[model samples]
Target: MPPSRTSAAAQSANFSTISVTFLGTASAQPSSTRNHSSLALCFGGRGDTWLFDCGEATQQRVQKSDVKMGKIRKIFITHTHGDHIFGIAPLLAGCLNGAGGMIDGMVDSRMEPADPKELTTLEIYGPLGTRAFIRSALRLTHTRLDGRYVVHELRFPRDPPGGDYTTLPPHRCELPGKNLLQTPMDDVQWGKGIWNDVYADDLVTVSAAPIEHSVACVGYVVNEQPVPQKMDPSHYLPHIKRNKAPIAYLSRLQRGENITLDDGTELLGVPKRAGRKLVILGDTYDPSPIMPLAVGADLLIHEATNAYLPGIDPATNNDDTEEVVQARTTSRGHSTPQMAGRFARLIGARQLVLNHFSARYRGDDDVNEEAKTVMDAIKGLAEKEFCGEVVCARDFMTLHVSR
Candidate 1:
């Protein structure tokens, strides 16, 4: 559990900051040092928690961390890959059976029946077939998540000639000029629109764009709404002390409204701080289409599955040739470290966090020497190629994001 909040911490916790906890970071397969892909995004301090790509045993990982499973309000699945979504069933089951207490004969319950009002509704967004997947899992496992969770299946607009693109409500950004929609040949329904606005609320808005992958996949960008300006209490304290102004005036001033003093002088409210933006990509070989959405993002979390570091020769290490590595990664729809760097640079991300490493990069010992070496190479290449802070993500690592 996290430490009790101090007065200062409590003051700062009012949605002024966002933090991301890496629950898992391995790719395709789990390693001794890493699990599959899972990320927990906490916004506005403890306001809301969102999970991206809950891989197998992700709930167990959450149990091992300081994150509160009951606080997870949303889950975004990049795709239906086992490595990315196998944990959804168990996690949903756990959410429905909060505190692990028996609920009307349901096993895995530990506490009293959870109050419906206190239970956070879990909204899951994912690519096509996601609804069926969740339903089938619940049925097979006999897990009852009836009103506890909702699944949203996203589909691309059909091809342009065959179908037209229509603008959706709550536009977040300018549409990408280039044609990013996949064609019929891709084996899935193609959409005319380059991006889709999946979720939105007063606090944050989320959008998704298709990316090049072996199967239908999409990347998500989350942008927080600009915060309201903070009121400068010092400026009004003098007036309150001198004239005993009504305390109600303080509420008006905090809402960015001008307050009229007894002397007819007007006082303006201070503007609140700006919000932050974050982008997280699914398993993809090409990230070009999503660059528009990722532009000016404060943080970009992308996969670095292949070890084809630039300026390094794979043959010297007695491993597979560079050409072989590149071909395999490309064919498998995975990105090399250099590719991740290039995308971060192209999108002008402020910070780049590389994860989703292939299991082969797992170190011989617990020290993770091989992974560190690869991470160093990636950081070096990205420093030269991009002008952003580069970081290698590890399981259970937490990143604090602020403006």
Candidate 2:
């Protein structure tokens, strides 16, 4: 078990290893065991985190767990639905206001003020207009945050030089303006490559692809780089036998170097082993577009709200007595348990973690069983196709992605 309280960097070693905590997993409404819908994906070594969604109770979840809210450098809002992003305003405030803010006042969390010169801006990435929504909410609430923040709109037809161009099948270069003038464009290209990232000394890359959903919802693929495997001390045994200076040189050698000493002595070409890879998807009903991108991900965190109620029609069936909920789920655009599992198996994730549940299912027992049922169902179906580990995620749960 991971320590209850620990620094983000201290939580794990490799960037290939990820700590994913589900704050809320319910659809639309809040439940005792599950809140709305939110997840924190902590990429180890990188010290950078990505939030899949921010539900209303997300702040409470962060306060109760070891996750550092201030460390959440990036957030991706899947859609504008209330359940997905209702908690963002408060979450941002909790980090910005330090000890006097929402969570600070509630949980007594502290912030060791950093020098102004060293502060890095918090980046919020989401669908088009998400920034506007957050700005409006902050303005209306009269909430003030101390840190610097910038919102980048993940809009369609991304800025030129990052968009698509078609070519003729005859291997001829088709000019952008003339090709579409006479013919209908059948193939539409999506995605603006993987997002290049650098957080402190850590590096990460993100890619986005359009998924089938009711509205304009896209799924994100997070590829985290793990810390380089620990250097074998035995490799530098001779250096330790020499002197302290040689040992210091070994440290540099482990950092991928061909070391040359002041006296012309050299330890040439010491190559460290490569690190692990972790892949995560925000939310997707269809698994096709994201498969290649998610290929060979050591760990894959996908939505599980739909995983429990396998084959149970969300349209005609809901445990809630209210009839509106049954119709709301599909109309509002959310996946079911079986749907989530199917996608995971299709994508070929080495391990599948399911999160984001419906409010109708409450209590740890019921949710766990529901999740088990879905995983079992998927396992039964996938036995002939694919074999991988599947898990039902709970709040504050940590797993070793690279272990």
Backbone-clash count (model 2): 8
Best by TM-score: 1
State each model's CA lDDT, in order.
0.71, 0.56
Give the per-residue lDDT of model 1 (tens digit) for 224-302: 7666665668888788667678877787677567777777777776566657889999999997777667888999998
TM-score of 2: 0.68
Report the C-alpha lDDT of model 2 over 1-403, residue by residue, as the tens digit. 1001124543444454566777776666787776777778776555666687888878888888878877887777776678788888888877666222223223221322346445445666666556656766665554545665565545554333322222211101111111001111233442333332212223445655555555545566665444354677776656545544556766666655676555455665455453444555555555455555666666766654443233642433445532344244445455554455556666666776766655555536434776455445533433333467766665666666564
Q: Which 10 consecutive positions of candidate 2 have the poorest summed lDDT? A: 171-180
TM-score of each: 0.76, 0.68
Model 1, residue 382: distance off in Å is 2.6
Residue ranges of candidate 1 with Cα displaced over 4 Å: 1-13, 98-120, 145-147, 159-197, 229-231, 234-245, 259-266, 309-324, 363-370
Question: Candidate 2's error at 185, in angstroms?
Answer: 17
- Candidate 2 residues lying further than 4 Å off, grouped into runs, are 1-17, 43-50, 98-120, 158-201, 233-245, 260-274, 307-339, 366-386
Candidate 2 RMSD to the real structure? 11.3
